[model samples]
Target: MRYRHILAACVCVTLATAWHSKATDDIAELPPMGELSRAIGPMVETMLNGGVAVGLAIEDVSGAGMYSHRADEPFVLASNTKLFTTAAAAVSLPPDYRWRTEARWEDGSLWIIGHGDATFHIIDGYSYPDHFLDQVAEALEARRIDAVDQLVIDARYFDAAYQHPDWPRNQLRRRYSAPVSGLPYARGLVRIRRGRSSVYSTTGDPIATVTNFLVRGLRKRGVKVERARRAGIREVQPPEFTSICRHECPWPLEKVLRETNAESDNYLAEHLFKTLGAEFHGRGSFDGAAEAVRVALDAAGASLDGFTQLDGSGLARAENGGNRASAATVTSLLRAMSKHPRGGPFLRSLAISGRRGTLAHRLDKGPMTGAIHAKTGWIRGSLALSGYMRRDEDRVVVFSILVNYNAPHTYDRRQVVLSFQEELLRAVWDHLDAVDTGWEPPPPALVQALEPGRPAN
Candidate 1:
């Protein structure tokens, strides 16, 4: 009996030793956070010299940390808010989701229902199948309905609010801040071109604008109107209508996301926000959309602490405590997005560094060029960048850098902030792999090359 007990004890000891060895190997595989902190500490201090509140976080693909500095503190995110909005959208909305517009003939009138197709206008580079209204007219012609007693616009898929209350009033006329409507035609803007100059204008009544444009389009396509004065925008019951034809937005949801993130298109972002509300909560109001976004984030397993999202476009600053997010939150979001089933489309939609979108002018010429895919955000007193950095095919790093300032928004200040951002990125990239096996800290000469005094190559 004593010999049998001894053999059993030996077996248990061997198993315990194997488990201990595996744990040690796992620890050794993690990045050297201590050394990374030492390397990036000085660069961060220099960059934050005059900046008010700055937050930064860099972690490996699995949320394992390489370095973190005040990453838990929240800072104004500006357009970086699009990252959250778009990611949630990608998960909630399918890849094939398309904005649809439909026409129906009911009670001697032609009723057109708009589903918030933001791309109903002639976007320069994109190919839309004929004009949307023209397609409707063609369908009418095919049915031999040359004349109609009246035209009704059913635009109630979204709430009646034309613009968000938090948006800047003065910028309302600009295309970026154009009023959003359930029925957006030409992205809710009218262009007036005189001589060699062209000016853009926004309408307080989007329904009226769409109605007028449709009247002209129908007339041009040989559809007659018996009483043009009877046309107006209103909500209609779906059961009372007989569907005639449907027109889909030219681009898919993924392409729309690409435009939103790459160009920082505020209009598209807000439209998508309301669309999410319409999809989940059965209401397209801002409140409903905000709630839907919150729910989606929670479902995606994202940490919501220290984050406040007021508007999808990030145009609205948080009131007592405005739109704010921590570097850790943003980095974790990136990590989560990467693991999502739709993560590929979401990540591919981001602006590639120095290649396209808003980043075309940034990180243009460097070893880091094309190595980062991120979103850039800038508003008065705030600047932020968050995304993934690919050191190679095997190593991916997620990072977020947010800076807030009290200085006036001026050209010089903008330049200073941009320079600091560039330098900081360069420093991170230079020392990223230094602690890896067989690698040493970056040499002094290489470190000096990233100084702000040295003009970019």
Candidate 2:
């Protein structure tokens, strides 16, 4: 059954109503941005005080546009870049695009070709397809193929830049840090579910195992487990494990995208990013994927102006270098996407704070609790939010806020900063005819960070 999250619907409505009053068209443009800044100066002051280096850009999709503060400057977009990736995929591929993971038998050997299907896994002895190995076994038995052979795995689609140098080294083994693959299964996760145990050991120990059971399940299909791991390319052997057939996957592409977007799964994001690269460029290297995304954006009529991309996944790696996106560019892309055929579904897939997916609990009791449907990105000191805001009369507004160099205090880093952001959004929500320019003093934490911290490199 499709997961119909109710909160998603409610939040969409709130945002739609919030911006309904103002002319969506540019004809009724508000006073100059300087005027708008003065109107909301108090809230902006609060954000700056809390040590948040923020850049926000909000627009009326229908008519006149107005912005306040640094809307033209570039800021680290973080995972908000996923919007570009998703938009590219939606436009380039047919609605039913499906990544193919294959197994081939030749001579006495078996070959697995990974087309970057990130969810390959078996849990508690149950493989993802549940019947995947059965298909392999059936094919082997039908051909009277049995005996021994080596398993050949191909990972040539992606280069060896597995870990990003800028990320904390300790995070490499995390699921979010899973390596991008031409054929990824289970997001390359070695599931490590742990629980308190009655075992005599005082310390809680983790029980970790690789799901998808690709190699192990193959052994069950009459193929001898001769070195049951990925080795060199083009493995060869005499006819041992014969008769291989393909089985349809359990999850479809839309289903996969829904889950990935809802929970902000980085592994899936990277896999999909590389998959697009491989599909379009014939290679899944980071550079290839990056190039493919740029090409896709250009094709979509997005200005490639002032855009730099080092990695498709945006995993904060040194190799990815760092890229920035101006508020204007982000909103322009959102506006374009909303007009696209699949825009509705794509927008609906993001998490709504205190409502669905990864954001179900955040801002649960706040003013905009059920009104913000956004993609949130956080890595160390960076925080970003981008998505559609639905106000009165079904008015739709798209906004992006990128905050870096968070303050050191608890309130500054958390509540105060979020409060300032929400306040700005509230003004947009109410469509207060014109912005309030009186600036609010920043939170103490933010004030300290801004004054004491070194300039961001």
Candidate 3:
């Protein structure tokens, strides 16, 4: 309740990160931000009795009039932590990076080396990885590779620390908390069928699972393997190995980001975090990944000053091991991404409120319907809605609403917190200081100001 940077609602936008639009960049000059502070100040204060640990921040691409309340204080980020991981990835890594898994014909043996491809599974009964393996099988068939001494599966690109240390032991078996690995299948989770429905659960060992999958794939295609096993990290293969086929996941990093942010897949999130570590720091462990995230975000203009990231996914408790960031810091990343030339994809990666992913059903009813594109985060005692709200190509804003509620974690309080978030967003739309298109209603204050001879300020 201590911070405020208010700006009146004025226009709509095509892209959420289209802040660099020169045509309407001067709209910030129309209204004083103080007007926004006065409008939403009381509305936000009344929620103290229902949910107290409220944090909020809203800003346009120019970083103007970001309504900030408790913006500087750190709050628990649940799945909202994916914002940091994905943003860092978007800015720091190669834009066209893909997850590569290769099969090689080595000295009298076949070898498969995996480099953190999470989409290595069949979808709608079509397996892309399997097809690539069939290509290898065809090459083997032509070479008269009747028998091989070993079919070695090597996932040494990532260290063997598949599970994060901070994850809850009780929840370890759940699909959401599935472990990360250098080589993953269906993002380290397996489908379990029950009656007419099914659920995903953690596969005990990702490497072994992938190994079995590849072994079956080859054997089914008539490539005989006498022994199949994992290759050691330090054991170097001879230089005589010929590249049979190098299969990369289709639009792999794009798919990973979508699954990580939109689907909120913790396994893929962790895979990305550790993979960043491997790519940037020469070590793929959790610490190395943490270092990589810090470096990446810092380079991209979002300082991790007060941010504490225990894991890539915000499954770890805030006070326990989960990541924490201030409302100001979350907005800092939003503002930074808005200016980043390549940040469009990261902004677009979020779920549309009324239409898609985790936020599909939440804000569908009112003016905010299909307007909010964001990541939703929820743990037992915390809830967050952070991302962009774009109505047209003129008025795009980035925001973060984080709340650490009182105990019991009841459904009613959850609704209260979310209601607060929607109202806060509605308030932002009200004050964004842009001209209306006549079909959609402007903010109440703007409507009043537009009446008769009143001037907008």
Candidate 4:
């Protein structure tokens, strides 16, 4: 069921009362933020004293105000930026959207076109069958094409610029900063293990690597690839190329989103981001993707003010200003999403605290454990956690917390910032228990008197 539907009756009652209630009366009835502020104030102050900037915003799921401290100010989102990217994708792409790897026989060659499947193979602890290429091989063998004159890898679906320009150049080889390409094999990652040493490598040339991998797989399956060469990836459908087979990524878009947000998969996030651009804006470039996301969010009733769309993975930080998003902005976005037709799937895609994803080890033993489903992000001195929390069966809250530490002692300060964030979250969770709902059943006497045959007091 959509989350908004679950709460609609309660929300409608609240709204109905608001229509007749005085504005001042409504303001007076809101749950006091003082207790929560007081509980979390020292923790926030400790971070501030230690040279950290914290942005926090919290509200009931109905978009009712709860608390705010620097919540309107923008801070670097780190991987929290994935929330925006994935949300936009969930709205733009259909639920069945699957990255397609198409193979066709053309001019004495088998052409494999990559549509940039991020989950092409097992990576980041998610197990996918290692035999995607084997399936293609089997398809070719069944067609009695024992040998192909050449194997052509068409990877031009996305721009040739593999890596985002704003990413840290030094970290390009790491799995987290893997390049984005039209054809990403093993999520563009390769691992080499020696007798005593192991190393990880990101494919510098994704199309070439995938092409070589396919050749090796086909040969293993008794299909001969006499020659393999790279070809330009294009969106144009080749009418002359007869369809041989199509290999689909293991997971659909929903699972892709779950993995992206839960594990903070940079490659998947960027791949989907570019896909958004390619599908909606007619270009897979970064600018196109950013604009596509903006358009999607705007269509969803989200405010785009002060929001900057950089790389989909949130690895890029603004050079002149902070990558800003107000707490209200994020909460509103979440609210809109919860009410969206696809809200159930989209909300389920987030990481459940203490259970799985990036939050497996966090909030594991607290009152909030198992109640919070959020996206966690960390980049040097920046940290973010934002998502929904079921305070109880009857109460739900949406929150966004972003912390940026300016201190040079980042390693030591990170722990302090994280502690404060956890403590603050607990405080909010506790505060929800004390919140007063303006809705109460009418007095028993009044109800009885209103009945047709009841006597008045």
Decoy 4 TM-score against native: 0.83
Q: Please report, in order, the local distance difference test score of every candidate based on alpha carbons.
A: 0.74, 0.58, 0.72, 0.73
- C-alpha lDDT of residue 180 in model 4: 89
Q: Evaluate model 3: give its lDDT.
A: 0.72
For model 3, how does the per-residue alpha-carbon lDDT over 1-457 read when each residue is reduced to its tens digit? 2122111111111112222232232232223346676666665554442324567777664566456666777888989999998987887778789888888887778888888876677766888777878888888888888677898888888889777767777888787888788777766777789999998888888888887877787788877778888888898976898988887877646566877887787877887888888899998887888889889889888857689887788887734446899888888887777667767667667777766678777667676676777899998778998987775554666788887754565555566666667777777787766422222332333222111211111
Q: Candidate 4's C-alpha lDDT?
A: 0.73
- lDDT: which candidate is best? 1
Candidate 4 C-alpha lDDT tens digits along 1-457: 1212322322221322212333333233333457775676655544444445667778776677677666766778889889889999888898999998888886678888888787777756754434566666777777777898988888777788788777777888888988888877877877779889988888788777777778887888888888998874534545798877787877888888988988898888999999998899988888888889999988987766678868888887757553457666777788777666655556777776677687777777766666777888888657888988775555677888887754453344555556666777778877765655342332232222112211112
Candidate 2: clashing residue pairs, number: 49
Q: Write the per-residue lDDT of candidate 1 for residues 120-233, one digit (tens) a residue.
A: 777786534246666677777787778888887777878888777777778778777776777778788887898999998887788888889878778877888765432333
TM-score of each: 0.83, 0.75, 0.82, 0.83
Model 2, position 112: C-alpha lDDT score: 63
Better of 2 and 3 by TM-score: 3
Better of 1 and 3 by lDDT: 1
Selected candidate, larger TM-score, 1 vs 3: 1
**lDDT tens digits, residues 222-316, model 2?**
55656545535444434464436654445666655656666787776777778778889876776677788888877777665666655544566
Q: Any residue pairs clashing in model 4, and if so which?
A: 156-233
Residue runs of model 2 more than 4 Å from their true location after superposition: 1-39, 122-126, 191-213, 227-243, 247-249, 317-321, 363-370, 406-412, 432-457
